[model samples]
Target: MAELLDDLRAETASFEALLRPLGDDDWERPTPAEGWAIRDQVSHLAWFDDAAGRAVTDPDGHRAALAGSGRGDGPGDVAAGGPAGSWVDALVLEARGRTPADLLAWFRTARARSIEVFTTLGARDRVPWYGPDMSGASFVTARLMETWAHGQDVADALGVTRPPTARLRHVASIGFRARPYSFAVRGLPAPAEPVRAELTMPDGAMWTAGPGDAESVVRGPVLDFCLAVTQRIHLSDTALEMAGSPAREWMEIAQAFAGPPGRGRAPVSG
Candidate 1:
């Protein structure tokens, strides 16, 4: 528990460091997320992190808070089998009035509270979320994944390339396990066939999932797999090699996060 929570803390702090130096103009810069500026990215994380804390410490209050505020990414937010976009838009509008400094402070306070609350959970404890309940460790990993994914958006907007970290294993793990949810959320039936993930980690270690002879395989750098699952980049743009119909089809619409059928980025044009 401590290890996972520690990683979550480290990931959140890393993102904070990135935001600390930005000014209002920088906050307003548009990211790959359609219609969301850098400020929106931070605000969304803050909103969800705050709610995550409330979910652990005060589940009823968490539900009530979301109910009062229009359920940003709530279960009822379904649209065309995906979570609605208005949820994030509503969250962004809530913080649009704050200056960069104020927003950053809000994010820091919210994240700190969430991490503190997470420390109280036992290994087997489950944390409630917008969609389904997740194990305490999974909850931490999910938070880490969310930060990395959104952080990618911020980095891309700034034309910055964050070096791959050992922490990417958390993101890749979620992407791999979410294969079923990925299909379900998109209103498609998850293929019964399992796809193997054979990825090379940042330090040249092999990370794998599924059976070796699964017939369908996605092999490449773990970083690219995470980016593809999060929809930060089109799969074809990555160096990943895909084989079998299941692997190819799954990669085309993979979504690691639980909200929407993401409007994944288009293939990079020359």
Candidate 2:
């Protein structure tokens, strides 16, 4: 339980280190996520972190918040509680009034509050989210995945190369678990074909999934697999090896987050 929060805090610190050095102009720079600037990414993280805090400390309030996201009573409802896609617009709209320093402060404060609340969760506890309630460990791991995925956007925008860490295992696990959701969200039937992953971590150890005998297999560095599922990189742009039609198709449409299907990056190659 303690290690879960520790890893999450470490992950948050890694991403925060990137933002702390950037100036106002850097904040305005657009990332690969369509129209989202670096500031928008940070703002989005901050907003969700705060909502997650409410989920831990005040479940009823969080439920109301999720309910409010679907209410189309007015444009304000979404800004108040919408999902990421629409929330991206709301964040961008608000970005006009925010300075880099102000946004940073918000992120720092919101995450701190959330962390404080999250530390109280037990292994058996459930945290409500956009989808069903997730266990305490899974809830925390999802935050780590979100931070790293969005951090990739910030890194790409700044043309920085981040060294992959063991943390990618978390993202890969989430990606593996999301295979069914990735297909279901697209209204496609889940493939009966089994898929496996044999990813090499930076330290040279393997993080594997599914059966070794499965005909459909995805092979790559753990980082590439994570980036693909997060939609931060096009599957074709990666050195990932996909065997069989199901593995290839799954990699193409892999989405580890809860939302409408993401507009994943287009091929950077012909």
Per-model TM-score on C-alpha atoms: 0.92, 0.91
lDDT digits (tens) for residues 1-270 of candidate 2 = 788788889999999999988878999998877667888888888878887888888887877877888722211212112245475576566766788899999999999998888889997798877766778888888888888988888898999999999989989988898899889877999989899999999999999999889999999889889988888877888989998998999988898887667777778998
Residue 30 accuracy (lDDT) in model 1: 86
Per-candidate Cα lDDT values, in order, are: 0.82, 0.82
Return the top candidate by TM-score.
1
Q: Which stretches of candidate 2 lie above 4 Å from their native place?
A: 71-85
